[model samples]
Target: MEVDDEIGSVESKVDGVGDRLCSVFSRSHWDSIKDSPHELWIVFVLKLLSSYSYFSFALVLTLFLSTEFQMSDVEAGWVYGLYGVFSTVFGVLCGWVVDWLGVKWSLFFGAILGTIARLLLCFCTAPRSAVIVLVTALPFAESLGIPVMTIAIKRYTHTSNRTFAFALYYSCMNIAALVAGPAVDASRALFSDGVTLPLTSIRLSALRVVLFTSAVSTFITVLVVFMGLREIEVNEDGEIMPYHPPSRQVGAWKATVRVLKEKSFWRLVLFTLLLMGVGLVFRHMDSTLPKFMLREFGGSDDAEGVPFGMVYAINPAMIIVLVPLVGMVLTRVDSYTMIVRGSFVAAASPFWVALGAHYWAVCMFVVTLSLGEAVYSPRVYDYTMQLAGRGSEGVYTSLASAPLFAVKLLTGGMSGWLLERFCPEHPPPERNAAALWSIVGATSMLSPILMVILQPVLHPKQSPNIIPPVLNSMHHLEDDNASEGHNSESSNTGESDAEYQTGFGNLERLRRQHSSSNSSSSSSS
Candidate 1:
């Protein structure tokens, strides 16, 4: 009753805000949004812009290393892998920054670092050193923003709408990804003819021009954060929660350790490891899978970009469409159950890709993988929020990204090893690529399977031997229903029993008719 009343109050307040604000969209259109406060929309725009900035430069960075710097696969691994390593480490540490400084200052610090990194990428030409600066600086910037973003989402929305909020958030990330692919091509094309300075007569190449644009994007993002956003703690009781002063560095570290010592953290860590492995396989769609397609399948480099970009776009496209629908259905299901199911389904997508001899097969892979992604991906954070406490949001959120760090560290070099081992640099004869997918698919799929198998043991509530209250309640309902049937039969001179029989007959008849219609439709189609 309290929750219901609170929701009602929140709704009325939000509706009033929506009505008062004049905008391009009508009040009804604003109402159609997930009933969040106006402040959250501001945060949402920040997320969209931040994602665009991150992916735009990142999409081309690895390729630049290999093509421009002539870095070997192993050397490039450090360029890519170390960023993940440091980011993951910094993410864990940023818990302190987030807890103490709050989103405003943390983001302030991030913007500064991001601005510097973007500027360096725009002009720096020394191969190893430039890449190293970017890898280090980029994570330093994101270390604050990434976890803080999740904490903000958790703060600004209620539980009922949190998953939907995550969908919107994840979709923005995907939209960035969707745009980044084409943006890569567009950036490449913009300065292909080369650029001459107005008076200095200095020249610049296509890559440098693209990096300059990336720097501009970062600058715009910094402006948005500095001018538009306000930092606050979670909302409660028709009031904004005041930001409580968090502990200093040492104290924050102690608090983080204390949080980790709890059983839920360990359980989450175990589950994260399982889920992250599965994610590594799926995320390769962006990282290595394109290179795989270009090498194994025969197509000109120019044409390959379009198909691969389309393939990257498809996953996010499906996610944007399906997450809300899947969320509604999975609301009653346990998070782990959803994770288990999604992992198994994702495992098969690569199997189909293995069967292929063409680029279309990669499209098929994205289609199959996306369904499971929509179902399970949002649960990752939902599960984290459940485990975390109030100010400790940063600590837990960072830990949640542990899988991303782990995957980057493990898979960056591992991909090259697999490619060389299975596909070969130049094959004596075309080898079976099926074996490659089978190895990755099977190995990756083990994580979630292990999670499902271990869930009952780790969490008592999920144990099969334990009877749920709902099942016990249903038994009582059936008993009362049977008693009522008996009473009706006794009161109605057998007419009620006859009516029951008639109802059952009608139900069976309808079922048969439905089956017949389905068969006819199938045959006709």
Candidate 2:
């Protein structure tokens, strides 16, 4: 959140400080966001603090392992990959738990868990213990917290502002990451080597200083969620709905099987899988890219050189600038189209690095990648929210990460091997940097291509409206079934494929056809 020098320049030109501030943003932007719920802002704060801690610590995690524990690049990559794999896996587990625990308790539990994990990392000196602490504790921290926050945002805001709410939620994460870059560098510079504890003869590395600060932020998140958050249900049309706790909840296994039985749920899984290669790009940014930059480009903060953390920050910073603008401008476009087009742009990003190993090329790669992520990533949440059934938002949203489970699972080992071969610390004279990124870029390019090829099969054809037509029609059909002597449980399981395919207009036609058939039978009799 540091103000750029441009703010000072604008201040000098404008009549007053308020006018300078006003000039930076248009009236329309402010007006559009005026009615957002107060809880949404709390969610933003929680997102900022929690994600800041996650990314800041993440930027240094591989370095921490390599330096503090004396792990090799390959070893660190496996552990780092394990961290990501478990994080997503736990996210799926936690999503089901959220349906049982409710949003507030889930947030509280996740924040406290993150705090404890950071504290554990601070004290652990051995590689075995550190790995144990990380793989066990930290994975559960933000993994569950993110989905809970997404559900919180969905509940707090009306449909009118919900999309922007998601975009802003994502922006808060980038803003955290945006600030984490300088913080990472400053922390590194402040402790040129490492700092010692006052009493116990324990030494803290520069990275641990960042970790400790993140722990404090997570502690603050606990306080904020406990004191600030409350339950508020918002219906599809922006109406305030009464909150009702389910009297009898199904077992997680049964609930999961129920969600899996739905064909649409399978489509979501397929879509998530198709996007996995591009998804691995994000995994590489944290697990592989930092080490790649330090080894290949060297870690000098200068005009000719770039620091890894600073380079890491570039993506989030551009995303912070671009997400709101994209959300605002692309309201008319379908989420499927946005995802496809944006994946193409993002998939092309690594080619910039393939063309050259210079800092300029790295900058181009990150900036281009950021632009594409800004276009598509927030829509991911929006699209997931659309597919989610009324009471199963957490389950459906978390299930989206199931495909990512396999993505991160393979990428961890894959990244380690790639770095060893192409961008190793000890270089063979025949190192091939272009081949490294060419592989990554080519892998990512499959997403958009397959997405286009599989659209008719996977994507639902619906108008680009606040609520998707299939979900809307499904809700209406459920109500009709309920009034016609069908119980909720029966309606959920007994619906045939034809009933599920009834789009908004087709649903009305089905009702008319049913009525006409009934009348014709009675008259003939």
Candidate 3:
């Protein structure tokens, strides 16, 4: 009743905020979005601009390393892999920065670093220099950028409206990706033979042109953060207000340690790690597909035939059209179930590529993959928010990115080997492209299969025997409290029992109480 009343109060506040914001979204979503603060819109623009810049350069990062540095597919893959590995590591290490500095300053810091990295790319001619730039500043910039953006989405909207808020956030990213496709192809086509500046003998490649453009977009992002955004938080009454962490806040390291000690954190870690298999397919799209399209189809980067950017653009294009629809339709589905269903669909996409080396096959792969992604990816962010404790969203969300680190580690060297063996720079008549994709397809099947097998364990309320001994002890403690008359009349034992179940947020709260009690006992002793 209290929850319902809170949601109702939130809705009443939203109803008076303003008129419908965007007609493109369905009527089902308008109630949720109409009340969104102007700051949320600023975040939308920032995400669009920053994402467009990042993806435009990322879409060709592997190609640039291979061509400009005169590195083989294997060497470039290792370098690209290192970039992904370190970037994710930096993200994990520095996610607390967002929690410490708030969204506004974090955006400024990350965007400036990104701008500096992109500018360096335009002039750096040596492989070692490129490697240093990619693994250091670029990683830190990317690491800080995403978690804070998502945290902004969480804060700038009402709790009841967070589903649509995250969906819109996902759509903004895809929309930017969609725009980057043409920008990439156009930049390459216009600067086909490369261009030399009047005063200097240095010539700029198509890749460098894209990087330079991306750099300018990143600079604009910094300006948006400076001029258009202010740090804000949703208050206890569910109203938007200026940002402040709690007065008794611990340092970032202590906070992280407390989070680590929670059983829920381990559960989140296991869930994300299980997700690494399907995650690899997304990584492969960037790492492997460009080379596949170019080599298998015999097309030059500047040529009209088989534009990789356009082909890559197809996924995000479909996502932009499908996300809102999926959200409206699947509003009642549980997050874990959605993940299972979506993983099944995504896992099958690579098998389409296994069918042949044809353009139609790759297109089918992307279309199917996008369909599954549209169903599940936004929910992943939403689900993480559910798991996070108050003031800890940034760290929890960053830890949720743990799967990508594994995926990157696997895809880098694996993609290079797959390409060399089957879809090499020069393909022979007997090249077995089918075998390569077949391996990818088969490996991706692991995630869904394992998820299905582990269902009983993941949702412990359904099968109590599968609960670990630690959970059993926790349950015993609750039982003792109830027996000792510590239970309140309003206590919901079923809800309490399901703390170890998936998709509940208060597990963190419960663990904290348990920890505080233990600490108090120790101090008394």
Q: Best TM-score goes to which candidate?
A: 3
**What are the root-mean-square deviations of the candidates from the true structure over C-alphas?**
14.2, 12.1, 10.0
Candidate 2: worst-modelled 10 consecutive residues by lDDT: 497-506
Which residue runs does candidate 3 get wrong by more than 4 Å?
1-28, 197-202, 236-238, 246-248, 299-304, 400-407, 428-430, 461-525
- Looking at model 1, residue 125 earns an lDDT score of 69
Each prediction's TM-score versus the true structure: 0.76, 0.80, 0.81
Q: What TM-score does candidate 3 get on C-alpha atoms?
A: 0.81
- Tens digit per residue, CA lDDT, model 2, 1-525: 248665664454333334323433555434434765567788899999988988888887877787778787678878888887888788787777887777778899889998998999977887888888777888887766877888787777643355556767888999999899888888877776778867778788787888888899899999999765666676534455555434126777777778888776877788878988788777777777777777776732121233777888899989988776665444334467667778888988988888878889888989999988987887777666656665677787778777776577578778778887887777673456698889889989998888887877666452222221343433432333333322212332322212221111122322343344433212211
Tens digit of per-residue lDDT, candidate 3, span 346-437: 98899998899898999999999999898778777766665566677777767666667756766788987887788777645356778988
TM-score of 2: 0.80
Q: Is candidate 1 or candidate 3 better by TM-score?
A: 3
Off by over 4 Å in 2: 1-36, 197-200, 236-242, 245-251, 299-306, 460-525
Clash list (residue pairs), candidate 3: none
Native-to-model Cα distance after best TM-score fit, residue 97 in candidate 3, in Å: 2.0
The global Cα lDDT (0 to 1) of model 1 is 0.61
lDDT of 1 at 175: 75
Candidate 2 has an lDDT of: 0.70
Clashing residue pair totals per candidate (backbone < 3 A): 0, 0, 0
| Candidate 1: tens digits of C-alpha lDDT, residues 419-485 | 5566543574455678777777787778666776787654444324222234353333233334433
